[model samples]
Target chain A: MTDVPPPASESQEIWRRRRGRNRALILVLAALAALFFAISIVKLAQHPDLFTISLDGPNPSAVQKAPAKP
Target chain B: MNTSFAETTVAGGGEQSPPSHSVAFANETELADWIALLKPRVMSLVVFTGLIGVLVAPGAINPVLAFTAVLCIAVGAGACGAINMWYDRDIDALMRRTRNRPIPAGRMPPGPALGFGITLAAASVLLMFIATNAVAAGVLALSIGFYVFVYTMWLKRRTPQNIVIGGAAGAFPAVIGWAAVTGSVAPLPLVLFAIVFFWTPAHFWSLALYANSDYAAAGVPMLPVVAGAKETRRQIMLYALILVPVSLVPWAMGFSGPVYGAAAAVLGAGFLVSTWRVLRDRQDAAGSSLTNDAPARAAFRYSIAYLFILFAALAVDRLVG
Candidate 1:
């Protein structure tokens, strides 16, 4: 049997709805991303020293000296 | 092509009936239906109260965080609304006020709405935790649970006091907001919660008074439907009287300045007068409204403005004081 395509009007209507749903999804995701990014920036700004990392030296208490001469 | 031709169309060599017109229309409104499920009107009040909570709290929150907290509260309240719609879809179809909702109108199925509510509920709580603190997130979660379990499932169908007890769910947003900033519930937020709690029965029952037939048709056991209009009016008056004192608690406790105190006094008096008119509205011997519930409708409208102006005054007092 040969395949039969949907009528043009029906196909267009379906596509319209799909497009709307997709557009809504995209907008929501973009908003969420922006919100998260803004939140991160604000949180980091609030406690700048808390998240800061010092590359100057390892903590002496946290470091293990090479086990003597093994 | 017409609906019949569309329905009988062959696709991929198989005889397939396309979706009906209503189904197609539902598909077209899919996004809008999802939003409608959130009950945006209710979310606005929740967001406003939550925002006030954040503003009035003791400590400073980054504006971004504050915004996030309010967004989470709004989303969480919306989630509750969606779930409430899902559970109440049966009765909703019976009531004129709710018959046109997405679910009852058959624009959306129940499963997706339930899923949407659950997903949003989880997301709001998790985001609240990340953006604010555990206390705020926990209260948000509790509010969701209470609305879904206690109010929607348990009390709403069972008792005339449904809104009375269920009102606590709506009261949570201010507490959640305060918790977001202070990392704890304080006296001010608690007072705000009490004010909203006491204010709810008067506000809701006023609406219920006019919507009595709708509630009766739906068998929801609302105050007017169960205890009759006279009792409902009395309850509305009692609650309004109690709300006046409760609203003044913020000023009495020194959490707010004289501006809020004066505003509360004036607003509370207006509220009392509104309820008094409702109580004395022209009615038949059976206690039904003789003039089509005009006073109740007016009271309902004034109650909304009362809360808005009252809270706005509190925020202004805090800002200026």
Candidate 2:
């Protein structure tokens, strides 16, 4: 009989492990995003102008104030 | 479920497929390869510059948020490093300096590396957006994209000016850091970005001078590989000459105090002297010295320290003032 060929893709173990790792990574990221969301909420409560998400325009927080007249 | 059975099944059924030879991290060195994928050494510089960026900005940040900002920058830098490693694996395998890297050495798979990179990149940017503001997150995302798409995929293999254009990716940290605090860009961070943009060639070319064969073997068209040693050396000095003065712009503009000014001037002169030595030393190409790269190696080491000291000086000046 001819020699058996190898698997083309990653083995089941590798895929399983990779999936597990990916899950863990996703979880950690989700937790971090959650923490950040909590922080943003707190920050927005305390400093509303500073912690904002924006699209299509400059963040209101970033606008530099003009110098006052002497 | 068994290993032998799985292997047998694959071998028996998968006639058209290549062998699935994936292995676990069998040792600490192999585990370290995963970390190496992150380019920790380079990440250190990114972290340092990013930290200084956050610190020296005029506005104050919540300590937790500041920590998060720095962590995001570090992870973001590592993410880019991983993506870079993943993309450059082919050339990395060819180069002596990178031949032993995880993907090239068969210690880690490319697919996972790519996943790791993209995930960290997305996570970092998202976290930055949530913890800080959109401006910082946007800049971080741009930096990662530029490094991956613009530098690694586009410029690196095609042209000698790759690093010059790719240098903008490295320069983004200062802006990211500053934006994390102020939630906006400013002149000081822009100048900081310029300093890094100019400094990159001098730093990388010195390493390339010593590692010329690696780049040449890999077909990477680095400045030293494409331009020849003399031209590369001249360019190194030219960039250093410009970098020194540009480094002082923060002080000149009054964003930083005199202490930083003095430190920048002194450190810059030293940087110039180091590059001058690199310019004068022909042996970097000749392989004549005991190290076979005395001048280039010295300059490469000094460049790292120079950046650290320069940014540290900036932070100190800000604190002292």
In terms of lDDT, the poorest run of 10 residues in model 2 chain B is B1-10
Best by DockQ: 1
DockQ of 2: 0.09
DockQ of each: 0.39, 0.09
Best by TM-score: 1
Which CAPRI category fits model 2? incorrect
Candidate 1 per-residue lDDT, tens place, B1-321, comes to: 222222232111226544454345444555777899999999999999999999889879888899999999999999999999889987887899998787777666676788999999999999999999999999999999999999999999999999999999999999999999999998899899999999999999999999989999989999999999999999999999899999999999889999999999999999999999999999999998998999999999999999889999999999899
Per residue, candidate 1 scores C-alpha lDDT tens digits across A6-66 of 5677667778878888999999999999999999898888877666766887655456788
TM-score of chain B of 2: 0.90
Distance (Å) between predicted and true CA of A18, model 2?
10
Please provide, for model 2 over A19-41, each residue's C-alpha lDDT reduced to its tens digit, 9 standing for 90 to 100.
Answer: 66677669877977777676866
lDDT of 2 at B116: 83
